[model samples]
Target: MKIIAMSDSHGDRETVKTVSNLSGNAFFHCGDSELSFDDPLLEKFHTVRGNCDSDHRFPSNVLVEIGDKKVLAVHGHEHDVKRSMMMLYYTAKEQGANIVLFGHSHLYGAEVEDGILFLNPGSTRLPRGGNEATFAVIEWDKTLRISFQNLNGEVIDSLEIKNFTKEH
Candidate 1:
């Protein structure tokens, strides 16, 4: 299975659409989607409310079960992501997820800890500090692997999550 993940669009529909069309796979908007609840995409998409998305009627996070994988998605702002990963880490475990996707830092982050995978797809609209407008794709198979891409669909980074589960 493949999941296209992105966050912090902050109302930039064009940027979101560009990346959205990059994959024919499932899509997850971590938060800051900044779109309306009735957005056509949300009907079949997994999304959460961001700090700016408060105007919309959606939760700040969501748990999705896809292809035997429990995935947690959040905006990250509430978790104080910049200071540390403690809050986000516990939340993922509490959610019983093997993978967690989040946004708010507008910076890409990924790691594997104690059988959990954490990922962040930086802002597609306004990236920080020389960061390119980016998004991510998690290709889940026997091993969950990640590929980070720029708006041009060029992969700028990659990772293989470790210790996230018993070999399946």
Candidate 2:
């Protein structure tokens, strides 16, 4: 599966549309989308609510089963994202997911832990540190492969997930 991940849009729906349309794949907005779930363009999108989203209609976290992969999606604000990954790691595991997609730090990251893949697409509208606006893609074929791309569509990072099995 090819999936595009992004977060912290803060309300810039155009960038989301641009990337979402080009990929022709499912889009996952980690959080801080700052838009109503009723968004017209997001009719087919999957997302979770962020700290900024106070609407009870949106959830702060979600678990989605895509093919053979179980994915945990969250915004990370409630998880104290910058301080540690311990909570996030365990949360995903508890969900029995093979992949975790989260944002809120507005940074890009990809790593494998105990057979699980963790990914953050960074912020497309308000990036932190020296990072540029970015998003992520996951391509899987019995294995999860991740690649991060900037707004210009240049790949900045890549990783492959391993140790994934029913035992995990």
Per-candidate count of clashing residue pairs (backbone under 3 Å): 0, 0
What is the C-alpha lDDT profile of model 1 across 81-139, one tens digit per residue?
98889999999878888889998889997888777888998889889868998999898
Clashes of 2: 0
Candidate 1 structure lDDT: 0.82
RMSD of 2: 1.8
Model 1 sits at a Cα RMSD from the real structure of 1.9
RMSD of each: 1.9, 1.8
